[model samples]
Target: MTGITDFTVKGADGGSVSLADYAGQVLLIVNTASKCGFTPQYAGLEALHRDYAERGFAVLAFPCNQFGAQEPGDAAEIASFCSLTYDVTFPVFARVDVNGGSADPLFDRLKADAPGVLGTKAIKWNFTKFLVDRAGHTVARHAPTTKPEDLRAEIEALL
Candidate 1:
């Protein structure tokens, strides 16, 4: 019965970040890549974060290089890209592997809690998003093609 709060992730600064600190908030956890085709979605994600933050909503981004080496930058480089390109205010975590044996524990749990299309647990691409409710339950799994703006309704429901 473990939920997201049971995990710890690395911050952009490479420090440990406890998921428990986000208790009572609705979260959109995304696997991102700086050089991917879907990289522009960061703007939409930031929009969602800005529009709903006061309502206890957040967008937690985790950069990953597993997808075609799309995110090859180091921590500082990734942070700089996010800030300069998208003006992202939400938390952008340290680089992590979102698939295979080296995947981050948090991402592994998320995929398990909300499997992809046809019950497949494997993530297809970068920008894949997992929506979590206030109780830390993963409510839905969104494909990379699912735009952030399209999630407003669901986010509102959770709020």
Candidate 2:
């Protein structure tokens, strides 16, 4: 059984980072898009990071342009938009595909760990979230429509 620690992802700066780096911390991994209707969820995600970061929880954002081209920006542009618009201080990774053969390996592992909507692993839209426990085991899958604030209680329980 592969855990999240087995995968590596690109950081916003174009550097490679292993999921192992975040091992032992509760993680909220999300595929995001700047121009989507759910873009406002950035506020809720940032709030969660601020609320629980000191207690070993982190929100990892991965910008994906696969959905309606809602995230067309490069790494710098995406990072700036997140920081300036929502004051998002959590880590935001480089843009990547959330579906199809070109999808990032990190996402492939996440989908395999927790399928959604009738065991389908394909990501349907932007902002789909995967919650992982401190041990790197994926615990829950939240659809794009599931607001970040709604996961607070669950995150708290994990923390």
What lDDT does each candidate get? Answer: 0.95, 0.94
lDDT of 1 by residue, 62-139 (tens): 999998999999999999999999999999999999889999999899999999989999999999999999999999
Q: What would the TM-scores of all predictions be?
A: 0.98, 0.97
The TM-score between candidate 2 and the true structure equals: 0.97
Candidate 2 lDDT over 1-159, as tens digits, reads: 777877888989999989888888999999999999999999999999999999999999999999899999999999999999999999999999988999898898899989999999999999999999999999999999999999999999999
lDDT score of residue 125 within candidate 1: 95
State the number of backbone clashes in model 1. 0
lDDT of 2 at 3: 79
